[model samples]
Target chain A: MHSWVDGQPVDSVPLKDRGLAYGDGLFETIAVKAGQPLLLDRHLQRLNEGCRRLALVADHGVIRSEVLAYAVALGDGILKLILTRGDSLRGYGLNPGAPVRRILQGSAPATYPPAHGVEGIRLFPCATRLAEQPLLAGLKHLNRLEQVLARAEWQDADHAEGLMLDMSGRVIEGVFSNLFLVRNGLLLTSDLSRCGVAGVMRAELLAQAQALGIPVVVADVSVEQLRQADEVFVCNSVYGIWPVRGCAAMSWPVGPLTRKLQGIVRALLDI
Target chain B: MHSWVDGQPVDSVPLKDRGLAYGDGLFETIAVKAGQPLLLDRHLQRLNEGCRRLALVADHGVIRSEVLAYAVALGDGILKLILTRGDSLRGYGLNPGAPVRRILQGSAPATYPPAHGVEGIRLFPCATRLAEQPLLAGLKHLNRLEQVLARAEWQDADHAEGLMLDMSGRVIEGVFSNLFLVRNGLLLTSDLSRCGVAGVMRAELLAQAQALGIPVVVADVSVEQLRQADEVFVCNSVYGIWPVRGCAAMSWPVGPLTRKLQGIVRALLDI
Candidate 1:
């Protein structure tokens, strides 16, 4: 995460940045290595579409240019880009005329989960439920209290993730990633058209699955269906692919397809 | 407003404040004058409950003392107090071991909506729909993009507020305040057990009406009901009572009961 604000690095942001005020912002966490941002275009595209969906103004070309310049200087690390609607006189109503702010702060050492693309992760079903709001389903806005609470449900750092369910106990996604299950010789994942982050890696996994000619079903899933799966895995742009094993009690081994997907993504990183 | 972090006026906070990260925070905007905060306890109660619900660790008395000290220094303005889960290492999980944060920052020159409590406001139905999540129903956490986009539905300065509907097309709340309508002398407002802010003023109005022998019903309302109302008004602790003159060409006047409630709130404010 190279630090830059509107193209310059700043140590602090105004406390009242609309991101703070209304969670009125978009963010993209890109995987970085050696010194370059991976899947940069995909992250930027989602960020732009997010801004458009919320009617926030940001020049994709300008932000992209700045990100590249900033990353080149920082060497290897993850990049987290946060763009907020700048300070406005206190009000819920938009200052349609207000300038949207760009907060490019924090360039930290990029570290992947130690078990990533290998031994995999363990997840527990969380009692905290996510609301179904299609308007906010896919956009990576800053209003993330649900994820915070759901993740906080467990204190064991060994558990890498928590699978959140909606009010009806329908499976949604991991706290930060999308979920996929292999059952009955088919590939299935929860549809995020209602509530969850539309992760960049999840998008790639879907595309690659289609290219592989696998049977993929995007629909509502229940805990019962998840429990009966032969294999399970979670994915996000930063983590790439992580198999899920022993979701508290049920266990799953890293499957063949999960490994093949990981190989292609690894090749991209090595490139 | 006076600026403080855990009772001290700090020059800067860590860039990693949870309020900025996961928006793991809660805030209260109060109308203050003559070195006193209006309905301070209600605001404090909401903030305290939010902190507990979000698993944030903090002493309530400390927050009370800090906010009071800051409010006393500023004779008039809006006091915005934010209690966040505080800064932590990278993860969606809460910092169970992290110290809580209290952000007391606002300008003393700030005033409530000019037309809100005086001449009332005009509103229009918003197209953005809120999702029903009982788990997150009324706590005013920082996940407010739903309201942000709804508030952005228009940019007219004269249009003081916009009324929001749930995905089911049921009327819920204004962008910030609670909604109320009068029909046949019955006081009606949207039930927020599923959506919208459980506003401080709305609670007080309910209590005030109950004490005054007026009937209050928390029920599902529709646009037609709003359009057919004899009178309409919106309220929040900051702006006591704002009458609605029109909502999408439907005209209403300041109802007799609304004016009476306004007088009651004004009396309390003068205290």
Candidate 2:
């Protein structure tokens, strides 16, 4: 693991990193393919946007260059970027001009989730609900206890992921990925303006579907709507996309839309 | 700082500690006075309840012993108790049987907000609002970006704390403390069952208020409500109760109720 405190390597962070204190940080996980970070520009864009929203500095070019360097050294692995509001003397009030830190760390030979891309996978409808707060929504910050607790609901390996519902009982997304369902030729996914991660892969798929003339609807979804959908799939930057074969007992047949999306992501990432 | 992982002294934690990853952990910042923890039992109760909500673990005696042993030699300072579901192979999913790790770090004397328990404070209403999610509303888990971002809004040392409102513009509390207002003999504040921190001090004040025959109403409060308030104050475990002299342009006076509550807290913590 490599880290930079105020842009310099450090043995340990001051125990008061806002990231650990109040999760006052943003992160990005990317796939390192053939010494290249897949969707590097897009990841940097999101990271920059998050920092901008929080009024933190955005050295887009430096972050992009540094992350690529770390990924290339690993040959083939996962790259994670964590940018935090450095340290404070003590208290919730910000110390103007406090140095910010960037941490680039991950393991080599990133293991993709099962061969479910070909065989498809199952999902469980978890009882845990994702909380909605637009101020901290979309951007992937470290405040992920909701996801951690939701994912802990069950440990069924067969179920590749668990579907999380929002406080309104609307199906939002999966534990670590975004959910999409095709019904009557329209692609449906939860709106991240409320809850759920705005996954880079999910964004890519949305653009691809728009170019393909497939209607994409971003709104609330009920369990019944998911059960009646023609097909379902969950996606993330790492796993590309995995078709949902069965949710509990209801099953999906891996429709044309699902397969096309998988192919598009593969071509985009050259996985 | 003294620290440990799985009972052995460690230099740093795996970057994947759920604590740093998702704030998928519970923590208690206790005031260690005279080599002993102040309000130890109360802090443990809150930590235990948070663990149950996240379904982590709660062997109170075990954690208590660990904290005491590490804090015995320490004089006046603060002890942070971070309990995270031990390491997992990098996923949001929790292993029900995952070992829980305790991180006990020490800090030197605290420098609290100036004018504390005295001249009162001036606050700014922050645009970043806390979301009302009854499930994770009160527990002081790791998911606190909203507060951190709000706190980062300014650097005016004399400005004191920032007031956080919900998305609907309803006044919630400060970035770190529970707010209380006295108006026409009634002490009112926002309810934590839906949003805001259930500060350890706030809870004690409620019980003490009942004993003193003070009417403490926990309900939704708005900016207008605060403007009409006669007196206002904020409290947390470490800060006891600090009166509010002004909020941006609107001003408030320190009332008898605010002083009475602070007197009770001083007697309790023996500050």
Candidate 3:
């Protein structure tokens, strides 16, 4: 693995980094292929927005250049970028002008069962519920204990992901990806203003669906509605998109819409 | 400062540790006086309970030994113990039997104005709202962005702490401490079943209050109730206790109950 801290090669970070102390940071996982980062713009956009919302000072241009350099050095891998509020006194209060720490690291791309995408995958209904906090919603901040617990809900390889519901029982998203349901002819996904990370691939798919003249509706999605969908799938920037074949007792075939979107993503990333 | 990771001296942790990646960890801030740890058993008990709730395996005996040794080495300082699920693959899924990382670090005790405990401190009514997550409530986990943002709400030295409220407009806690309202002859604090961390000092105070034959109530505390309290104070193991003198248009004088608890804590810690 290769890594850089604040544009310099480093093996570790300061123990007092806010990223580890209070998770006062943000992160982006980008798919790198042949020294190129896929959906770089979207990832950077989300990171910048997260910094703005969290009131952390960050240099986007410097971060972008460093990420690109780290990705190029790795040649073909998965690049993860972590931006933290840097070190501060032992308290929640931030030091007004503390330096922002940016870490770029590269690892080999994940190897998932090929059948997961072709034959679709099963999902477990996670017992962990996402709390509704609009103030921190939609931003991919580092406070992800919710995701950590939800991801731990299932252990079987058959289940590629887990579905998380909000406190109100509204279907929010998957353990590490965004959820989407194709009903009739419209693409429906949960509105993330209340909770859940606004995933990069989810945004790309929504735009692609609109460009393809498919109706898209972002609203509060119910598990009942999800069970009745014509097709369902989960997406993230790293893994692209994986169709959902079964969740609980309900089963779904890889519908035409899911296949088409998969094709679009594959072509866009040239995978 | 002195530090250790998994019983070995270390200055940094792996960048991919789940503690930094997803805040999948628990921390205990301990107060050290002379050469002994204050409330050592209580801190470890809470840490064990948090591990049980979060499904992280931790050997209480071993951790207790390590923490005690580290604290004794520091002699006079604040000791912080962080137990994380260690490094894992890129996804949120655990590595089944991954080693749990234990980090123990000591820093000099914080220096606040001596008048904070005597003359009382001011609080800023934070705009940040705590999300209700019962599954994660009462546990002092690493996912502390909410507290970080709330603490950033006020930078003035006069506003010693920020008052955080839950989504329902119920006063939850101070940014770095648990809140208590002294009304009539009773002590009232917010119930932690829905939100907020169950601080070690707060629990001790409750038991002490009961032993002193003072009525204590743990329930939803509203902002209006807080404003009308006979006296208000915040407590944490690190700083012990600080009475509240003002918050917005409301002001409070340090009452007898506040002074009594302060005296009890001072005696208990022998500070």
Which tens-of-lDDT digit does each residue in B87-191 have in candidate 2?
A: 656678665566887877777867775566788888877878788777788898878788877877767776678898886788889998889989999999887
**Least accurate stretch of 10 residues (summed lDDT) in model 1 chain A?**
A105-114
Q: Look at candidate 3 and give me any clashing residue pairs.
A: none
Better structure of 1 and 2 per TM-score: 1
lDDT of 3 by residue, A144-182 (tens): 999988888878777889989999999999988999999
DockQ of candidate 1?
0.67
Docking model 3 quality class: high
Runs with alpha carbons beyond 4 Å of true place in candidate 2: A1-14, A108-115, A219-228, A248-251, B1-11, B95-98, B222-225
TM-score, every prediction: 0.92, 0.91, 0.98
Between prediction 1 and prediction 2, which has the larger DockQ?
Answer: 1
lDDT of 3 at A12: 82
Candidate 2's displacement at residue B221, Å, is 3.8
Question: Chain A TM-score of model 3 versus the true structure?
Answer: 0.98
Order of all candidates by DockQ, from best down to worst?
3, 1, 2
All DockQ scores: 0.67, 0.59, 0.88
What TM-score does model 1 achieve against the real structure? 0.92
Q: After superposition, how far is residue A119 of candidate 1 from its true place, in Å?
A: 2.7
TM-score of chain B of each: 0.94, 0.94, 0.98
